[model samples]
Target: MDNQLLLSLTEKYGSPLYVYNADKIISQYNRITEAFSSVKNLKLNYAVKANSNISVLKLFNKLSSGIDTVSIQEVQLGLEAGFYPENIIYTPNGVSLQEIEQVANLGVQINIDNISILEQFGHHYPNIPVCVRINPHIMAGGNHKISVGHIDSKFGISIHQVPHIKRVVENTKMHINGIHMHTGSDILDIDVFLAATEILFNTAKEFPQIDFIDFGSGFKVPYKEGDISTNIEELGEKLSKRFNTFCKEFGKDLTLMFEPGKFLVSEAGYFLTHVNVVKQTTSTVFASVDSGFNHLIRPMLYDSYHHIHNISNPNGRERYYSVVGYICETDTFGSNRRISEIREGDVLCFNNAGAYCYTMASNYNSRYRPAEVLLYNGNDYLIRKQETFNDLIKNQVIIDLD
Candidate 1:
C-alpha cells in the first residue's frame, strides 16, 4: 500500500491499525503455485495460526487454498469461512485426545505429532485415516527460540521413533494417509530444507498407503531492504524435480503439500501507528507510538525485524531514532534506525506485519486491541473493529465487594 492510502486508512480507522493488501496476498499465493507448477498434484495449506481473520481465511478460500489449523478454534474458523472439512488439516500440538476426536468428528484431516497421541487416537479410531508429523531433527529458522525441528523441540515425533509409530499403526490397524514435517520458519538455506525433505521422503517409504507428503513450509520473506530470504523459485525448481522422481520410485503419484504462514501474507500486511510523542533523551531519540507489545509482540518475543519507515514524511531528512511503544515494559520495535524526520501525529508504517502480528496480539495491560482493515478490489473494508472497554470486560466477572 502507498503512503497516502495508509495515511488515509489511519485517518479513517484510527492509528495502531492493521491493513492487509489482498492483491499482494493473491500474488504471493500465485508465486508459489507457479513455482511448483510442474507438480501433477499440489496443495497449499495456509497456516491459520499466522493470520486467522475470518476475512483473510475467506480470501484464501476464494483462492481455493486449504488450511492448516493448529487448534479446534482455527478449524472451526476455517469451517465458518466456508472451507470444506476435507480441505482443512488439523495439526494441533500437545492437545487432548478429546480435542483430536472433536476435530476428527468434523471430518477434518487429523495430523498427530507425538507417539502417545498417535497411539491413543489409533487405538480408539483405527478406521480413521491420519497423518504423522515426524521431527527430522533439522535446525532452521531465523531464531533458535522459533526453531522446532531440532531434537530438543517438543513439536514433532522424533524420526528415530518411526519404528514405534509403525508399532502403533500395526497394533491398531490404523491407516496413515500422509507424512508431514516442518523444519521451522525463515529458512534461508535450500540445501538444509531439501535435506529435511529427504528425511520425510525416507519416512514416507514406511507408509505405503499415504496419499500426500507435506513438506511443511518455512520459506522466508524479505524483512528489510536487500534482505536475504528463501529462494522459492530455485528451491521449487530443484525440489519439484526431486519430488517427481520420488513419486516414480514410490510407484505412485502423491500430492505435494506446503503449509506456509508467513511466506504468503507477511509482505501484504502493514501496521500503521501514530507517533504519540518524540522524546529526546540523554543520548537517544525515542519515537514512542501509542501501541506496544500488546499489539505487536514479535520484536520483543522473537527479535523479529519489521522494516519501519516514516510514511508521513518520506522525503524528510533522515535521523536516528529508537521506535518504542507505550507499554509499561521494554517494548522497543527498533533501535537506532535511520528514518525520515518523524513529527508528532505522523503515521509510521511497519512493514511485513501480515503473518504473525495481529494473531499474536493480546489485551496486555488492559489495553484494547487494534482494528483491522482489508484493502481488496480497490476498496477498504474494516474487518475487525477496534476493541472497546466493553470488549475488554465482556467476559470478566466483578465480585460484589461491599
Candidate 2:
C-alpha cells in the first residue's frame, strides 16, 4: 500500500480506522483454492468469526465461497449476504441445544462437538444429516490458548469416546454426513497436522455414511517480516494425495473442507491511528496513539505481534519507542519497538490487522468503534461507520429520580 494513499485515507476518513484490501483477500482465497486443486471435491468455508462485515461476507459469496459460522447470527448474516443455507455450517462450542436446533431449523449444517448434545440432537432430528467434531488430542500450535485439540481442552469430543459416539449413533439412527477436527491456530508442522489428519481419517472410517471431512483451519499468517507461517501449498500437496487414497479405501468420494479465518484475511488489513502525543519519560519514550486495546486487543490478549510502521514519516530516522494507547490502564501496543520518528498527529499503520483486530473491538472507556474501509480496485468504500455518541446510549434507558 502506498504511504501517501494511507495518509490521505486517514485525512478523508479519520484516524483509528481499519482499511482492508479487497485484492489481497481475493488472492489469498485463490491461494487456498489453488493449493487444494488436486482434490476431487474441496470446500473452503470462510470462517465468519474473523471479520463478519456484511460486505466481506458478500465478497466471499461473490467468489462462490461457503461460510463456517459459530453462531446463528453469523448464519443470518450469511443469508442476508445472499448465501444459501446449505453453504453455511454452524460449528459452535458450549452453546445450548435449543440454539443448535434453532440453527438446524434455519437449514444450515449442524456440527456437534459434545456427546450430550450429539445424542440429544440425534434423537430429535435423526434424519437431519449432521457432522461430528472430534478431538484428536494432538497439539499443533505452540500457544495453549489457541490450541484446542489437546487432552484438557474443552473444544471437542475425545477420540477415545468413539465407541460411545457409535453407540449413540446406532441408537438414534442419525445420519453422520461429516467428521471435523480443529487442531488449533498457527500450525507450522505439516507432518504434525498430517498426523492429526490420520486420526481424522480413522474416525471417518467409523462413520460409513460420511460425505465430508472438515479439517478446521487455523493456518497461521506471517505477523511480521521474516516470520514463519504455515506452508499451505506443501500441506495441500501432501493432504490431497492422502485424502484421495482415503476416499478410495472408504469406497466413496468425500468433500475436503477447511474453515479458515486468519489465513484468509490477516495480511489484507491495516489499522491506522494518529499519534496523539510523544512523551519523553526518564527511561522510555512513549508514543501515545488515539486508540487503545479497545480497538486491537491481540497484542494485550495473546501477546500477538503486529508490525507497526510510521506511515507519515516512513523515511525518518528509526527510534526505539514504546507505542501506547490512550486507555486509562496500561495499554501498551509494543514495548521498545524500533519505529520511524513519530510526530504528533502522524499516522501509524499496524500490519496484520485483518483477522481478529476490529472484530474483537469493544467500546471500553465509552470509546466508539472505528470505521472500516474496503479498498477494491482503485476505489475505497466505507464498510462500517464510526460509532457516534448516540450509538453509545441507543439501548440505554435513564430514569429520572428528582
Candidate 3:
C-alpha cells in the first residue's frame, strides 16, 4: 500500500521483483480468527503449495497457524520454518506410497485421498491416525479449473464410495481420525461452502471415531476493486451454529479445520516490474514490461485479473494500453487496460500477487528469476536472491561431443 516502499524495493532489488507485506498477512489471519471467534474448536492450516517461501511459512508460524503441505519438501520447509510435526498436515494427492511414508515418518498428520494408497498404508500402519478425503459430489468454486469436488474430479473419494472406505477401515482396523473435503478455489458463495460442510458433517457421523472434519478452504479474496469475496463473518456465524449442533448430537467436541491459502495472502503481495518500452501501434498502445509469464503467469494461465498501476506515473493522464511482457510467446498481461499513463523505465505494480504468482514462476526463456522481499513490521528483508545464469545450467550435464 505504500508507494514509497514499493519504489525503494524496485531500486534495491532491481525490476520484476515480488514484495510481500507481512502486516497484511497477519491482518488477514486475524480477520479469519475474529470471524470464527465463537467456534470452540478450530484450526487454521495454511496451505503451503500456494506459496512455499520459507519466510512466508515462518510468518504463519508466528501467527500460530498450522501448515498444510502437499509434498515432502513442503513438510521439510514447514519444519525448517520452526513448525512442529504435530502442527503440520501432509495432504498429498496421487503420490506413491513411498512418498506418503516419507512424510508420515516426519510425524505429521497424513490425509489420504485414493483408496489404493489408503488401503496399503492403513494395512501397514493401522495404529497411525489418518484422515480420509471425501468428494461430496457438490459442484462449487468460481472456475472449472479450480473446482475439484465434482463427480468428475480426481481429488477425493466419492461419497458413494463410503461403503468401500468403511470396508477397508474394518479390514485394516485403521484409526480414521478425520474426514476432509476440498470443493475448489476462488469460491465466493458462502452458502455453497456451508452446503459442502453439511455434507462433510453428515459423512463424519458415519465415522464415530473421527476427531475432526476439514472443510477445505476456497475462501475468495477480492482481486480487483468492488470484486466479491467470501463473507467470512456470515459464514462463521452460520457454520458455527450448525457445527455446534452437530457436535452436541454426536456427544463429543470435534475440531473444525480449514486449509486456506489465497484467503490468507492474496492481497499481501505486490509484483513490481519496470516498463521496458512504450510502443505506439496503429490501433493500440503497448506498454511492454521487463518481465513476462516467467515472473507472473496467472494472467496468461488462468485469465486471472490483477490490478495494474503505473507506480511511477500514478498522477499521469489515464490511457488505454495493452500491457505485455518480454516473453517470446504472445504473453499478454492485459489488453485495452485503462491505467495511468505508462512511460519507458516507469515501474508498474501488480496487485493481489501473493498466492500463486511467484510460486508458479518459471525460467521459460532462460531469464533470471526475480528476487523476493518480505516487508514485516515496517522493515524489508530479502527472502530469496535473484536467480543467476549459473543456476539455469546448474543441473545440466554438459558433454563435449567431439
Candidate with top lDDT is 1
Candidate 1 C-alpha lDDT tens digits along 267-290:
999999999999998999999999
lDDT of 2 at 304: 91
Please give the RMSD to the true structure for each candidate, in Å. Answer: 0.7, 0.7, 0.8
Using lDDT as the measure, name the better of candidate 1 and candidate 3.
1
Arranged by lDDT, best first: 1, 2, 3
TM-score for each of the candidates: 0.99, 0.99, 0.99
Instruction: Kindly list the per-residue Cα lDDT of model 2 for residues 180-226, writing each as its tens digit.
Output: 99999999888999999999999999999999999998898888889
Backbone clashes under 3 angstroms, per model: 0, 0, 0
| Model 2: CA > 4 A from native | none
Check candidate 1 and list the clashing pairs: none
Q: What is the lDDT of residue 392 in candidate 1?
A: 89
Task: Judge candidate 2 at residue 48 and give its lDDT.
Answer: 94
Which of 2 and 3 is the better model by lDDT? 2
